[model samples]
Target: MDFDTIRNHYGILIVLSTFISRIIFNGFCWSYGTVIVQLKKQHLNISDTELSLIGSIGQSFGGLLAPLILFLARRYGYQLTFICSLLTCVISLFISSLIHNLHWLLITYSLPYGFANAAIFILGTLICGHYYPVNQHIKHISIMCIISTGFPIGYHIMSAWVFSSIEKNEWQIMKRHLAFIELIATCILGPIFTMKYSSNIPLEYQRPSITVTQNNNNRKSRFSLPIIVWLIGIFTTMSAVNNFLLHLESYLKYLGFASARADLWFRLHGLFDALFRLSIPLFIHLYPVNIIYLFPTCVFTGFIFLLLVFGLLYTSINALAILPIVLFSFTSAVTTSLQYTVSNQLFDKDETEQGYIYHVIITSLGLILGPIIGGSFLDLTGNYKSIMLISLMFLLISFISFSLTILLSNKKEDTHQSEQN
Candidate 1:
């Protein structure tokens, strides 16, 4: 077959690579809370608060470093870097299985695993962007959503399997099983497919003609103006706020909910998050992209839902708690997915690596800060109500920020059309 035909067939490989890679990463991502429990059990001297702190530290490190990994991928080949990341996680998992001390776990496994998780999260999106055409971004992102949604499912399965095995005194077997699965799925598949599909042409050659750099000095001047910076701040805060909802399960359990019920609520949140993420492309097709308004607007409403949940607004049924989780998760997926799509479109295809990196830096900022801010506040009050309110305020700011971005983009488009006329 001709090269175009080969590329067409290669799309399946792209999807498969993404699917397996996500599953491996998802295993680690969702395993945090479950493993935190195990660590507590293994080190009985460690307090619950201390375990939460360790997890927070690990996640904070991961979020902060995620963009740096993508930056390195820009210099080195993403294909090579991604493969190395997968292997790193595999090695970490194996070593973690052999150790018992908390300090040793933090240094050898926790730190490396944090890097592994960050690399996977950022590179998954980068790979999807690399292989797919700009027009196909939404479709491709939808596929990513489907694969990513399986993360929570994997989390539950792994948690159950590990806990059950440990109960049966089969810790070694379970650890080895997880290690082999992550290794084969990510370390093996990534290099083979990436080497096969990654382009030989450098990213600079194919990027968009317009650049943030050209606008950088102008952008800096503009930043001094309050409105533009305000918008960026609002957008950043909104991103962070939405992220807070993702960790609600831990927050709720800390608030006195039963562990089983809390986990169930968390999964329910994922189900909604996944469904909304998966459906967005279809929704974008049926409705104007402006229909994105509904998501943030619902977010504004969901804050009220949180208050109700926290203040005994409802009967306190298990299903009732699931409501806010569902709403927040759904909105989170929309914003997260939309941010990637919008960033991909901002520059020409040739500049996507930089564009993707730039947008992700914006995303990474929120990821790094959200937990620190939210977790600190939760610790201070032991009540999530204040945090929910803070999140609600940020969502409002985000709504305004997005609205302004749309306005600015529209103005630019109009000016270009008039110039052509």
Candidate 2:
């Protein structure tokens, strides 16, 4: 009947909390394409690459600061860490709304906002599985899958709803809108996470942030052949994917689609992505975390890239464009969802943390590089099709990287078995 009673059975709250954080993070990060277009109009003199850095710079900082985030979470509990980070996020967004200068926006908006979103999303999702019993395989996996779906779902919500509601020149209002979202999330979710551990949550959920002490003997080197190839695959794939996500709105405009239609297509693309991610519950039930399966996901993504490239080759690009966009979003969602679990399968039990940290770094590097490269290319050629071609190449490289990972990991296993024999 009371708040404590509600806190005791907080599984739904955890889901909602993590889900909303995902929306804010993914929506803002991925939908920066909308943000960049607005900024470009206001600052006609500023280069695209420079404006792109507003989002890219934040991602790089977030990835680079993963260790610090870990330390903070451990030292101060996930609840406190999330609260502080989101608070900073609220402040950052508010301050950024007032700033018109590009440099100041980069410093105020991107850096702290990126850092805060990373902290909240990482810490929030990290404890997600803790809510379910270890024996509840489906429950655990399904919860995570459901939570992860929030990313693209938010992407669509932001692109379609927020952009369509605000005029193109209303960049200032957009930042405040985002800040208010963060504020509401902070106010609501912060207290929910701050609840006592003895509530109806699982035993593993007793402490939001368990101390992972230094164990040099337990530290697995991430430089293994499989990991290197794995990182390479991820790096290349995200470089293309993030670039596409960041610039799709602009690219659609370039393709002769009206702004409303562009927003509609953009939202639909992300909707397809979110809808496809719903399969993760069934997927985890059938195959679990089979790293080998990721190879096909990458190949499919690359295949979609090829289709997208082919789609752009004609003047009647619009006639055939929607199909590839739908397919691309679907395949991309599958690949992106599996990325975290794949790292767990690739590394030893102890190495998941290290591998994940490395994973975040590599992913951030890709996100950072994507906008810069994509922006420069777009600036030079004034074409979005070229972006597709380059993205296709990146996907191809990722496919090859994943191939090497599978082959080398298998070969290493065989060699070890032969020696034992």
lDDT of each residue in 1-421, candidate 1, tens digit only: 7766776577667667665665556545555665665555566666544554455444434545655786677677667788788888788778877866676767766577767776766776666655664566556656656555554445455555555556566444566677888877865677655635544433532247667786675445334333353336434554454345435655666577776776666656656766776777687667656543554454556556655555552355645666765676655565555544554444544445554555455555564455556656766776666556556566667656655655666687799999999
Q: What lDDT does the true structure give each of the candidates? A: 0.59, 0.71
| TM-scores for candidates 1 onward, in order | 0.79, 0.87
Clashing pairs in 1: 206-350, 207-350, 207-351, 208-348, 208-351
Local lDDT at 5 for model 2? 62
What would you estimate as the lDDT of candidate 2? 0.71
- Candidate 1: where is the Cα deviation over 4 Å? 38-53, 56-63, 66-68, 74-76, 103-105, 137-141, 147-177, 198-247, 254-256, 290-298, 301-305, 311-318, 345-350, 384-390, 411-421
Question: Residue 49: error of model 1 in Å?
Answer: 6.8
